[model samples]
Target: MGSAAADALLPLDASRFAAESCAVVDFLEVYYRDIESYPVWPDAEPGHLRTLLPDMPPEDGESVDVILEDVRRHIIPGLTHWQSPNFFAYYPMNASTAGFAGQMLSTGLNVLPFMWAASPAATELEGVVVDWMARLVGLPECFLFSGGGGGVLHGSTCEAVVCTLAAARDRALSNLGHEAILRLVVYASDQSHYTFQKGARIVGIPPSNFRVIPTLAGSAYGLTADSVHEAVKADVADGLVPLYLCTTVGTTGLGAVDPVRDLGEVARQYGMWLHIDAAYAGSALICPEFKDYIDGAELADSVSMNPHKWFLTNMNCCCLWVVSPALLTSALSSNPEYLNNVGGEGAAEVVNYKDWQIALSHPFRAMKLWLVLRRYGVAGMRAYIRRHVDMAKWFETMLEADERFEVVVPRRFSLVTFRLRPRHEGRDDMEALNRKLLVAINGSGRAFMTHFVVDNKFVIRMVVGAAMTEMRHVQDAWELVQDKAKEVQATP
Candidate 1:
């Protein structure tokens, strides 16, 4: 520290902060209100922002107005507006008002509550909120903190998978010896998120030992227990040990839900740990009707879901619960002299969240989730989800009535997978035709959608779960698809 360098830092002036924050709030209000006017996907090329910015960092502190002006000029154009109601790409990562308010409050407080000693309220609030969520979603009692199991919020589903997989790996290795890691296997359906395989690799599970059981259209791409059993049987015959099975509640590509109860039975029979990844569809569990989808959740060793995706929580919030918190603490906990609490009086009662994940320091993520839950209550959240599901059903009905299009799979949650039927008889390239329609529709900037391939058939996925999306946006998107399909069909 030189005097000049220190002087460059912004002063801790409360009045200045208040004025700057008001400006930021105004900018964001306009940005969110007019989000639809922007393209769902940006037209900017790769490295576009780099070309527009200065090559070097500014040597001097900049005024708030100057920084915000640059953000409007250079940054806004390059962003793909995920908040836009017309945006129907991947599963929604909604940013509700309550979530944002909580996030802002957390940032203002800027607390890193890695352990109960660091910030007891933060740690305690996290545990309370996650348990509250468990009850709301009808999760098994074993996954609640009071029941001995526990939950922790992670940055994403991938981190949760990795942590749970690591715990399972450690437990298996303890009994089978470290060298037996090569013989231990992990299983997941092909329709499951790629995070399972990625998590396996990250946790040192041999690539060859990762088994991806193929899912069939006959079952709507749901992973069946029979398929998992057959895979495990083949692996066992080859002298391999089944260590873990990942069953999905709502898969990413097609919103397929594996039978958790049946799969858990198979996992238990083989002494394997069963983990459920319900990143998208878990929010629907708030309603009693969707509770049946996760009927076998009691058998799971661990489960995870993303509130950011559908529960009106902003990005970077994933809730993971395990039937045995000790498994995670034993696998991931690190003891360091500098980080220890002063006294051991409440050691047994306190939760050191740092022991629950890969990172030793994490944001006060529970604040946003607590706010979302409190602001909406369970009934409001359920109604919010139902609105999206209703819109999706309406879109599915519209597609079924039109002869030119075919609903690819049953509408699950808020996603509808559909495709334009083959125009000419004996045409074998329907995939290419459907892909062109998607490209054109997205290119028009009137609306946006993404696609998935089911049984080699290209299907367009219209996800209607964004916080601001309404029936009107869905109707407009359907008309756009129909108009684009007509153009695509008329062309060579």
Candidate 2:
């Protein structure tokens, strides 16, 4: 414990490891205990942390205690406390203590299960956990391991979209050959998450090959079956091949739910692959009441949802289900001499997930899903989903009571998008006013939320998913918004 030379800390022994880990654990306990008191967003501009810390890593190892001190001093201020009770921005990115423990366990094991022979337990656990997830959500057996298709955990929906698109592309190319790759087209609603566009680009699909079909705002910004049918018709008339159709269960900006059942029929009729992206609202489906929203998705070729977005799991974990595992593996699998293995090939029926996704080495993400599911049983999980939807409905009622604000979109799950309509005359600058109000609300540091432009109107999006968020916090946020809007309007 004395002030020894930096070299003394070079190699951490077991005692030193325990000391550092214990110190950090103590720090985390205090940090989460006081999370509500912290600012949701930092006042410091960019480069604040870089300016405060040393320009380079220490030439010699430093004591973990010293690093901890620097972290508390410099890192804490720069953090935007997404875990705060008032963080009603974007989707409900909720994380629980169990999720943290699961992540720590995964980090400890650090197994590379690229092949079943590499680690049988790791591969099997993922398959089992994914199957459990599918069953708990009432997904069809076609997407389960017992069926030919199955699910895998990805870092995000972007990765899932890209992987599934690759599979669909390869399937199309098998029949149409490489020249048709340019003619191959993917379709999504305008309100769809930008991830689909990003995925299409990553999969080498031409920009012109991707179609951005506009959704009707009057119908809650949902992509209609008629609109898609027409788009496909036009594409076919021009000799363009329709490759894939992406239907979203929950859109990002407005939380729109495209008509999946109707769209699926069109995709089926056209022989195009159907992929459903439920990154945000998928967690709601766990509750039986919300099962109706995804009724048509069972027939789709692929589907994905993110527990990290709303299901009390940590960040960066997405669960993807495909109706055809053979198609996915065939497109992605590369049998290099170095990776040759017979464990899963002959009699063993082991599934090496490396061939199912872009990455060969996947983290044990199933631990978080397993841990959270165990901590909150099926009943508890359903109750959690119901609480958020109920909270969202409550917020919507509050907005409706107020005459100045208009709910731009229908309440879907926990996301509520509303925009301000001026009660006073001669104030056509509503968009500018809402922007100013949003700036003031965020600047207050009492709470933090985000805004979006829907149907050419700026709207505030409030998502209630922080595990600690309560009714009182929601009420307080509205009061703050009303005050902020008044301040903006009163200004010259």
**Top candidate (TM-score):** 1
Task: Give lDDT tens digits, candidate 2, residues 1-492.
Answer: 345764465454778767777898899889889887888878988887877877788766676789989988899888888888889988777788888888877877777777788888887888988888888777888999898778899899988999999999999999998888889999998998888888888888999888999988777888998999999999999999999999988899888888889999999999999998889888888888888888887769999999998888897789999999989999899888888765556644678888989988888888888899898888988888888788889989989998888888879788888877765757558888788888899999988989988778889999988888888888898899889877887876
lDDT of 1 by residue, 1-492 (tens): 457877766665788888999999999999998888888888889898998999998876677889999999999998888889998999998999999999998888889879887888998899999999999888989999999899999999999999999999999989989999999999988898898999999999999999989999899899999999999999999999999999998788899989989999999999999998999999999998899999989999998999999999988899999999998999999988898668532667688889899999988999999999999898899999999999999999999999988888898788999988778867737888899999999999888889988788888999999899989999999889989999999888
- lDDT values for all models: 0.91, 0.86
Q: What is the C-alpha RMSD of each candidate to the true structure, in Å?
A: 1.4, 2.2
What TM-score would you give candidate 2 relative to the actual structure?
0.96
Stretches of candidate 1 off by over 4 Å are 1-5
lDDT of 1 at 35: 89
lDDT score for residue 364 of model 2? 83
TM-score for all predictions?
Answer: 0.98, 0.96
